[model samples]
Target chain A: MSTEQQTIDPLTPVLSADWGEKRSWTRAVYETGGGYDALRRALRDMTPEQVLTEVKESGLRGRGGAGFPTGMKWGFIPQENPNPKYLVVNADESEPGTCKDTPLMMASPHLLVEGVILAAYAINAHHAFIYVRGEILHVVRRLQQAVAEAYEAGYLGADILGSGYDLEIVVHAGAGAYICGEETALLDSLEGRRGQPRLRPPFPAVAGLYASPTVINNVESIASVPGIVRHGAEWFASMGTEKSKGYVLYSLSGHVREPGQFEAPLGITLRELIDMAGGIREGHELKFWTPGGSSTPILTAEHLDVPLDYEAVGAAGSMLGTRALQVFDETTSVVRAVLRWTEFYKHESCGKCTPCREGTWWLVQTLKRLEAGQGEEGDIEKLVDLCDNILGRSFCALGDGATSPITSAIQHFREEFEAGMHTPAWELFPYRASTVFAPEVTPA
Target chain B: MTQQSTGTPPISAEVRAELVEIGARYPQARSGLLPMLHLVQSVQGRVTAEGIEACAEVLGLSTAEVSGVATFYTMYKRRPVGDYHVGVCTNTLCAVMGGDEIFERLKDHLDVGNDETTEHVDGLKDITLEHVECNAACDYAPVVMVNWEFMDHQTPESAVQLVDDLRQGNEVRSTRGPRICTFRQAERVLAGFPDGLADEGPSAGIPSLNGLQLAQLNGWGPPPGRAGSDADRAEAVADQGRAAAQATAEDGQEGAVATEASPAGTKHEDAPGTGGEAK
Candidate 1:
């Protein structure tokens, strides 16, 4: 059951390179390691269109959950508009079981800043914004310091490296709202409105910030650009599958040994990832793991061989969302784990759209009942029905994403749920009755 | 053709002096609005019509101009709040972690539903408790915001203890919610457990509920002050027209140039489209 410690073969190493060093935020260390070289190469050898074309050729999908092709999204901007285009890096990584972005910002923010400059140049945006979640004050301070360092090093601000491509990068801390993780919602939040989803179609590429064409990229997506620019498109593309090209950060958590962010090729299997992370904790057999954050479906041990690629995972009925693989061992009950996640979705539902707001509530209610040993025969169907109602009906993907784990968990662990039907949870654990019923309640 | 002014009147001398004094402290004049609103909100308990008018007057803008900015955000309340404004997090994470329990406890304690505030315990009758949507502290699920400050990781014991602390006028520090529970059997039970709980018992199956269905069941609705700018101003202009009509009716004088506002979603030249993202 225990996975042995194995040396992981690291792929592309842009984000995690300087993470181990102290004061990695300083411009000196960043420049010494060939940082901002992409800016120089981009400004000197290429035009905005050329950089866009290069990225498009490189086949970089968004490192954000959506996994949209980054260059195709960039190409959507209308060239005729004279309005100032904006580059916004969505640092609002609030997904449960997803905790890679903030750590990146804390350890190595210069990569993000450099990525912002390169992306801003490619998109012809004069102003770039990094919309960070406000809850992480330390991360914000680190980023702010990194931005100051970047500005001082002349990587940011007007006329950077005398390329006449003047760019100003602003590090904005969003009053923490998970709905802000949605692109339009992030924009609305940036505009000082309540962080709620706006109708997309006029996606940020068309009528973004101040009605100008805006390019909103994920922190890892933008951060990945610097690496792609430095390392040729072929080098970046050679690591992964044809459709999902490049190395991604796989965040292995839960019962896994050495649980942390492991950068690997896209097509890496869960078994390989589990092996790389030193397998589950001793004596614990792998039960389930979320391929992405909790938003994606739960991939059980039976699916351990499934490639962690966009299409491959989808073929197996899950997404390679954010590459957040939260591993769980046998000690974890699928019912309890799903109930916890369902509760999270219900709590984070912005209440803007109907399906997510209401569906999440019902999901939580059902999960709570099932977890509390009060589940009915019809409860599983009801849970699935509620998830069905939420999946496509809600305003944003958050609603759909919320249902992935619930349905998938039920599909895998119907027995755990069935076990709870006739037994009351209090009787099963009489010694811990204080955890559920009141201490004053007399034993029957 | 139009008799009414589109913008607020030019800054008066007295107002200009205060604005200059306030504006000096901030790196930008716009940043001054934060403090200016704070001053105004403190001077008048809540943002009153006259208070908004005075802010507009002081800032050299129309009433709609100031109200537009204020109402667009949640912090500024259009209606009066109870002494203690209890804003609850009813999002999915909190919901699963017993948000309803905390909500019901507060409702029963305060004797009010979502938007209703009880009259003060002593001389302070301004205390209103609202079960608002997610306040974005999911790590600390089942959170409540008591007047802009967040109280996280609330169980029934924690929530009741929080309210008790608040009632005793003790300031609570923002903390993370309970660690991921061991299981339903091992987790801490919230205080004041009520009957008719939907998430438990024979009905304890995952419902085929969607966002819209959940919203309806849980009293979720669109946020207040969603009326777009043009519609709001038009409504105000229409109010002005009605006022003028009433005056004419009273004075026996014929009215000219109704100056009534058009319906909403119409564009205004002076107010730049507050679109895209917030600064």
Candidate 2:
């Protein structure tokens, strides 16, 4: 058998524990591995306020698309309120190229479960919910089983470990709407309304589920808690950059030698990650990649050395969303791929707001034309115009996320799109376009 | 051709009493129409022709009255969709991603198209296909909604696999919402089963570059008899571009993408030159 060589780094694959062990979902196995030992330490020694302060000092940010400060968001919840407060974990990893959350939830669910309980304790919330996307039922089942084990072992449910802090965890599934992936929209969905985004300011922390204080966070963000509690704040902070601290799961996918999740420091570059993943697939040159999910802009080979962090990627006009590195090879058509993505946003537009609803539709139309080699001179500009409408105007980040790929594709590979316009896609791929656009040629 | 009456009309004593109590919960009587329609559908299994008429009468409207609202959204059905409603998005986004291939696959599987339903199994039809606009999961384009439960990142292969799994009574993995393992018709399905055809006037035209080009040069709204003059076609394209730009401008971002690119949505010269990234 032919084996590929992979380079090693500090941020790459240190957590090589057996993923297929039996009863891996159990609290006992978790405790044996120094899990929820964090919870014991957190609940026994640290005050709830201290937990918040330590987490803030650690400088942990939300792992979901929006990199909001996790500690600050937790701090936003009213401490004095008597109403029911909640900790809802956004496990809806629907963004294209975002494969980090599911792996974490699948392989190490206890991490997230422990994080949720610890978080609920920190915020003094009696109840917590994990709003997982509906698709991954296995992960859902695993989480449900994990929570059951936690409750049975006194890690969750009333009077955990005799601390008198009662915490109940509910794992809820969302109807497949990307808008629900948005924090506020996820809250609206959890409340059983059509999943449209509500106006923020009364964020989930202030007025969430049933208008009670809520701390909505990503699964990865919550999962990091147990590690932070066990390792201490400074230990966690010492690993990464000065501003963007701690280790993150870098999910390397597509056209890579070893496409898998790598836990690394924040400022690691794509070149480093690729080296860890055994570099790009042999014989194929890397063309472009998404820094996070498809919702963030695509970066080309020129950016392979760009540091993978919140601030550096932000400086480059792309987000470090979920750290989902989807590397594509040279054979991939940027225009064709972007056209496919734009079509997705158009179809998924909730139609609640005008900019996203209509703008997405127009974007699909233009992108479809461009992909088919029918794009006129103004098509690229039209796409930019349409993306402009969607970026800031739409009710939620769903709209903004939809435009990321389109603008980025145009930014990096404008000529590929222009070439398509001059020659029909049929001529480029001949038999390929003929079969694809067969129905378009048929009479109604 | 006539305006239908508004408000709940006189119904049978039993149905009227039930609807009145249900209607009382909402501040606006019209909001009750959904739940009331649910009531009608449950009582009749499917929203029957008579049941629709009764709902209109109970709501104090004509048959066309309930039909209009029933067909406007995708939730209510005028005719019986298959036990499972397969609403495939054949719009531009999914279309470019080979959404039409799903239509062919479904037609082959169910032996039906948008206008037809397949042979029934276990008191329900195998499948039916309807083209819908964006289903809101663009990340997974070429999406399919099986009974309002989204199945994202779909391909012709995936669609075929899904149909087979549904046929074999295998548990389908639902992406969001309740995980209904079996094929059961939704209580409230929108009218025109596949397309909202029962509505007045025409539906949104499928815009294409070839059609747009022809419309720009020879003048036409869409196709065949719908063709307009070249000037009219150009005007319409311009208007669509302007409307898009105006909407963009209103959103506070510079409408630079639309305006700067084409200015008036004029077809740029099909020159072999690189396009600029709009952002």
Candidate 3:
């Protein structure tokens, strides 16, 4: 893995370092590779406060959608609260474009296991839960095994290596609900209720699980902690831009030559990552891509040079949400993509808030009309108006997300929408040509 | 057990014990309702009315509540599922990359619509075909999941062939995991029971490491992290802190293992290293 010393290597495979190793998820392979050393150092040497300080200093943002700073979130737990604290790792990664956490937990389950232990210790929580999505049975199996292995290894459970801290990790699986990815809905689902969002401000740190102080974090965010603790805060902060520190898994999929999880310093541009991925497949020009996952507004080829860090992406008018960059070429229809996403949001909406539930269904209907070339002249304006009503009006981000692709696609590809109105989307951009399975057709 | 059951429960004694065990694993008890529902499905295909009663009884909740929870999630089906449940990714990226085509082909071949199960033919295991949303496996776009095991990089032809193989009861394996198990058996694993298949297949797949493969091919590595003495400073501070703790407390090695070095542990210049433990 050594590179020329003169070059700042574009790829930094920290979380993914051992992903390719034989039997990487096993305790035998994991311990041999220093898997629990961070736990050793935390429990043996530093105080819990000190461990918390190192993380706060690292400036690690939540790898989940919102990008909230992890340490600050940990700090929010009221230490003096009488109720027992909890740490829940949100493993329900069902975002349309997000796949980083799945691969992370699949290949290196121990990383998340160790992170759970360390994070529990940092918050003084004796009990932690990993609420994984139930759809991926293998991931649940891998996690269950890893947790058992950690228990056997004494990295988890009471008094690890003679340290006087006790913790227990539970692997809970959620029934299929994308809304559970939303933190409060996750909390609700974890509580064995219908997964739905709750009103905020008693923010989880103040009162969560069973109405106690709690710390909920993403799988990647917690997994990154071992790296920060092993290598100093500066080591983590050294990688990315000032605001968005440390390395992240940039998932490059769709229309790319080699789509996969690219772990790099946060500020790396999509242009460079795409170049590293061997550029768009067969040199088809990049038409539009999601800077983050499907939730964040889509970016075009014009924004390829924008750094993928949170601040830069926000400055470029999109959040660095889960870093799920789904690329597409000109042969793809912007309208069709937006409609598929819209249908997804509608299907998965939890029906919690009125705007999201009703608005998404209506949006799907209107987009279907538009895509089928049966739209009225003012339908484009109506679509934007629907997006405006749905944005920020729902209980959670699902409604807001349903609006992103619609509003953004309209902004960038209005001509495509307008010109293609007399023609169906299948005629405007042949679905066959858009997909790789079909034979290649040269761009106009 | 105060009047938890209204009538004789229809599930087996062992299944009831598993349901109770799932409930006992949670601190709140009700939190185990989801997994209990899964266990119920594993035993009796779909969330049966009696299954809801059992879960409600186990968690001390009303059957109405349990039914509400079951109906809310997509996985908890009202209808009985086939022995094998095949899901094709039909979200945007996967759809654009031919998931739509694959799904259409499967529907035609299986003679079933979305979320519908094929009829048993001469004792063949029923196959339920559903077009699933983005399963977060878009890197291998147009991915399919048989009993929730990833079948990556699938084309329409391959998807049809896969369903056919499943119907024929041929031994099929996950693209990244073990031999394909029945949907009910898979649900047992989802209910937090190990199928002893953890070590069956490769932990990671090709698409999971495309960038790493290219980086290794190009001899690229991470930049020198935390330049100018972070390595030394952090260690010195840690050593100082350890010494201070050692001075106050009697240090006892409760569980000690022989220390040896592993290749994955060795730190490389200008790059992050994997964990090194006392093996």
The prediction achieving the highest DockQ against the true structure is 3
- Best model per lDDT: 3
Question: Which candidate leads in TM-score?
Answer: 3
Q: Distance from true position, residue A149, model 3, in Å?
A: 0.6
How do the residues B16-122 of candidate 1 rate in per-residue lDDT, one tens digit apiece?
45545554532234434433443344333345676567667665777786676565444455565544566676543344345656888888876778867765565
Which candidate would rank higher by lDDT, 1 or 3?
3
- DockQ-wise, the better of 1 and 3 is 3
What is the TM-score (0 to 1) of chain A in model 1?
Answer: 0.92
Give candidate 1's whole-model lDDT.
0.61
Q: Compose the digit string of candidate 2's lDDT tens values, residues B2-94.
A: 111111223356655666655553333443454455445434434567767766766677777666544433444555555455777664334
Candidate 1: misplaced stretches above 4 Å? A1-11, A424-444, B1-279
Question: lDDT per model, in order?
Answer: 0.61, 0.62, 0.83
DockQ metric for all predictions: 0.02, 0.02, 0.33
For candidate 2, the chain B TM-score comes to 0.54
The better-scoring model by DockQ among 2 and 3 is 3
lDDT of 1 by residue, A1-444 (tens): 111332223333335544432234446545555567667778877899988887898799999888899999889888788888888899988786566686567556788998999888888888887887644434555677778778887888788888898888766655435777889988766664456788877878999776779999999889888776765565456567779987777766555545556556678888876775566666557778788877888888889999889999999988889777766655455676677677766766778888998888888888778778888889888988888898889999889988998888878877777766866433443322211112433224
TM-score of each: 0.64, 0.66, 0.91
